[model samples]
Target: MPKSKNKFGKYLLIFWGLFITPFLLLIIIMFMASKGWIGEQLPSFEELENPKSNLASEVISSDQNVLGKYYVENRTNIHYYDLSQNVVNALKATEDIRFEDHSGIDPKGLLRAVFRAGKAGGGSTITQQLAKNLFHEKPDTKTERVIQKLQEWIIAIQLERRYTKEEIIAMYLNTVEFSSNAYGIKSASRTYFNQTPDSLSVQEAAVLIGMLQAPTRFNPARNPDRALARRNIVLSQMNKYDFISDEHIDSIIALPIELNFQVEDHNFGLATYFRESLRNDLLKWCKEHINNATGKPYNLYTDGLKIYTTIDSRMQRYAEEAMREHMTEIQKKFTEHWKNKEPWEDHREILEEGKKRSDRYIRMKAAGASTKQIDSAFAAKTKMQLFSWKGDIDTIISPMDSIKYFKKMLQLGFMSMEPQSGYIRAWVGGNDYRYFQYDHVKEGKRQVGSTFKPFLYTLAMQEGYSPCYKIPNIRVTFDLPTGDQWSPVNADGKYGGMLTLKEGLAESVNAISAYLMKQFGPQAMIEIARKMGITSPIDPVPAICLGTPDVSVFEMVGAYSTFANKGVWTQPIYLTRIEDKNGNILQEFVPRKVEAISEETAYLMLSLMQGVVQFGTGGRLRGQYKLGMPIAGKTGTTQNQSDGWFMGITPELVSGCWVGCEDRLVHFRTLELGQGARTAMPIWALYMQKLYADKSLNLYKGDFEAPKDPLNVILDCDKYVQPGDNKTSFDRDF
Candidate 1:
């Protein structure tokens, strides 16, 4: 009996040992998993900060004063909202109805997913999708996929512990890629339909949610049929789960998956030209700053930055409309002319063919066509077949087509700024931004023509030349340093022998400007121009007075802005401030000012410029457009009419307009068949008319004071004395 009892005890002990051994092994496995020795571990917050991690802080618009995007009104991103109840409900019903109730793994969903993968191939859960987007490296394999699943499970549990179910859903919506270049629901909505996420209809929301399965395959923009099919599946799922009423699900499914299909206006209010100019300027400034620091090229586009710009949306639209209307009129006229002659095909087609022929001829010349050969070619029968037969033969010889072509060429850009505050108010960079990206307003460097005369006048004034002092506008040739005798002529080609300093400037007399340069000495004029914000190097030559220097519209605009701002010059600035995601200011732009001219001198100069608008070449603008304030401006035409320019100012705004080809070739038509005032000025005037429609905004004018220096007064008189005038008041001193 004792032996039988001992046998029973041994059997009992062995069975107990078997049960306890399995529990011990299970504990060891769980500990190993927790320690990440046997499987992938969950990512901690510190792991997210690892240098090798692909994740980076998201960039947001730095504009604080404006809500949402600075330009777009009433548009808000998903990031701005803190997990709205509707959003959470929508996502839960659409993505995973059992998400909150399940552990890291959903058993029924997993089993179903495995069966679907075996049949229709790949399937992923929300955790798996998040792992793919946030953590998994590419070039995927079975091993990598397995590891990813393990990591996802671990991370999903960690996420569940750290964040509420609503927060996880919010982050998922924000991070998921819905379509090409559309990383979040907000961007996806904007890119596909030009609507905000919150504004999305039930149908639209379902379509976006449907994209979760296969974004590219179900992209409504690309595959409408597939998108609709996927959307119906989501609607059915919502109905099956009782998340939405059966009637509502049926109604949603029956509704057409009609997309608004409104594209985002990347141009931003017809200011594409201005945007391009601003972009180029910003790029250049960024590059220069980077080069100075690191001696290497830096691409501003890739750098995460907030670039504030100087464009006024209202002014920009007005400028674009004016330019388009005027140019379209010209284009219509040309088209009509071509149609009247051809009568068989589209006039634009004929014009295009003619352009090609002209281009070939130019190429031939560049490739080495001798003068005699070119003349012979022009006289040949083959030339008629190739060039003259194409379109209006007169277009080659007359400036009409050239003018129309340059206007159509749309190379000109105009920019205006408030010199005192460096506030850029108006900009017209190109006729169309789609065709031409080079912004003449900021990047183009063309000869200033006679518009630069003011600098010479300013120098003469600083040296004691008064506006009332008379000077000779007679035909005179000067022996240049290069031994070439340079003879300057007036706009009308007739010398007005003796004229007051005011008349000389008002008339834009080239001879008078040249004479002033010689009298004041080129070095002094250079100094004055430099001081007034003309950064382009000026040649110390007599022709410099006649505006021989090549200056950018930006430089000229800034210089004129000084004259507008009571002689205080401020650097043109675009950005106001930059801030990080936490609202910490990274950079702030402060307006920098320098005294370019005395307030008295600036007022006097402005008075003379007003005469230019009232009586000179720019006077035509007054007749065409009613400017409600005291206006000062200058009109400039280069030699051979290659460049046409107008720089004008009111007390409130300073603007510069330039019209010319990229090449220095003469190509434009004028009212007098001679100047830019007739062609470019009309464009400028049209833009300004729309700009100043608000009567509340008027020019700021104040009292002017004369200089106190006796020597300055004497010098002003001496420098401005007209030729043949024997009023030698200072002769005794000499």
Candidate 2:
């Protein structure tokens, strides 16, 4: 009996040894790997000292609001102190209940998890999860995942030794990814609620913390119901852990999850077009000005640069709102006009243009796809989200059809600048940037229409043509310098026998403009335009006086700004300064100024333009909008009503607007509906109204400055003629 007992005990001991040996071996191997004794290398000292994470660069408005960011990761680090206690408490309650007591790992929780088969929750400490987040790479197979888990455990212990409890929480919060391009607590708070981390309420904090488990599955904007349920669960956890009272939990659970969902995409912001235009300048700047710390060119994507821009946030918002308001109404009228007609004159050409720009075409071409395959792809009807002023709408439309739809839509570009400082106050490149990216401000050039008359008038004034200089308004035939006889007629086709330069300009008389161009010579006019900062190429031909030359809104606004600034042409400046992540100044930008024309000449031109707004084509400024301030402006309508433009000037600001269809063939048939005053001037009036309503803006009021020295030009028309008198060639005022 004794011999049998001994044998049984020996067999039992052998069985226990077999069961425990593999587990013991795994522990030894993991410990060796953690200490660099095994084949796998642990995180080095330098890696522990400095973590490699992508940080975002911010674009700050002049009013000091974060407009948006340029980033690879969209991560903005915030200190623990900046985080609300509610957020911290929520994270602790939901993620790691024993976060405070645990060093790096909780042995008791691990035992409990093992016994309950992880039904209660994970035993991984916050530090462990952060270790996995920061250092552990995703594994493809189960064996690799086990190896990655071992690496996480080793790094977790290292993190515990290196950082404090508070630091671990902050780092964890900063490293995690929230939904919708929001990478950290600060960014997530801003993206989800349009607020900062420090201002997050208890419920808001819970909603953000609840996203940690699965960002897409519990996105507040995309999956509100699931996100709400997850938020309730987090609040319940807070109650169970005594982080919050039962009354607080009950109150929060009943409260709905309110979200201010602002998408952090490149195309969804107040200054999308401006930012896109600025990107090229920034890239060049980054190359020219290398970073002192990194010994490499600064990356706009990851260097965390604070690009301080000249854009005023309030004015920008107002400009965008005004554009949308007017464009929406205009679009309705346009739809009515085209109800019975096809919007596009050439559908095949439009489709070809679309095919060239389609991302799918580009991708397939890069992958060596055949042209037939590409064509088939474009011809097939596919699901797409089309942009509308109301919102993005999902529908089924072929790529070819989408282009035709976009062509039917009218487009607008607007820019406003301070004449004295040349600071671009507001810029709206298009009605909707997502649909139309062609920037009429700088990249696009359309016939200047009557907008070019100001440049011609500026030259005539410089050549000693007074505002009251009389010119015959009858039809005049020009024996062309190009050996081509050209006769231009006014839009109304009625000839005023004789008219002052101011009156002729006010009426946009084509005959008088041609005569002046023939007198001044197109070469001289072109030189004056160059002096006034018109960068676009201008043909030295007599027809240019009628604004046949194509020019961009940027050039027109800048040229107009010269007249407003009393002939001092300051090149428009978009960026004011740039700073490093630590707020150290990297570069400062100042407007480049040059004298375009004499102060007297500019003032004379300004007075002539004022006559147009007061009594002629732009009379609606007072009759319709009731803007009684001293405003000098010009209205432009291109041939066949293809483009409408308005250049408005005050003592302080100079703004230019262009409204047209993508194709010149698609336009209103009549001048009454498509003229600059009707199509574009109202937008300027509405925008200025909003500007004046904002008392905080303090846009200057009153009149433009008369020439400081004695004027060599006649300004007031009443001096030359009596009121209520109409005599041909008699210089009558009324």
Best by lDDT: 2
TM-scores of all predicted structures? 0.72, 0.86
TM-score of 1: 0.72
Worst-scoring 10-residue span by lDDT in model 2: 725-734
List per-candidate RMSD values in Å: 10.0, 5.4
lDDT string for model 2 (552-641, tens) is 999899999988898899999889999987789998999889998999888888888999987789999988898877899999999989
Compute the lDDT for candidate 1.
0.63
lDDT of 2: 0.85
* Model 2 clash number: 0
* lDDT of candidates 1 onward, in order: 0.63, 0.85
User: Could you give candidate 1's per-residue lDDT for residues 334-385 as a string of tens digits?
Assistant: 3543443433123345443444346545776788988666545544433221
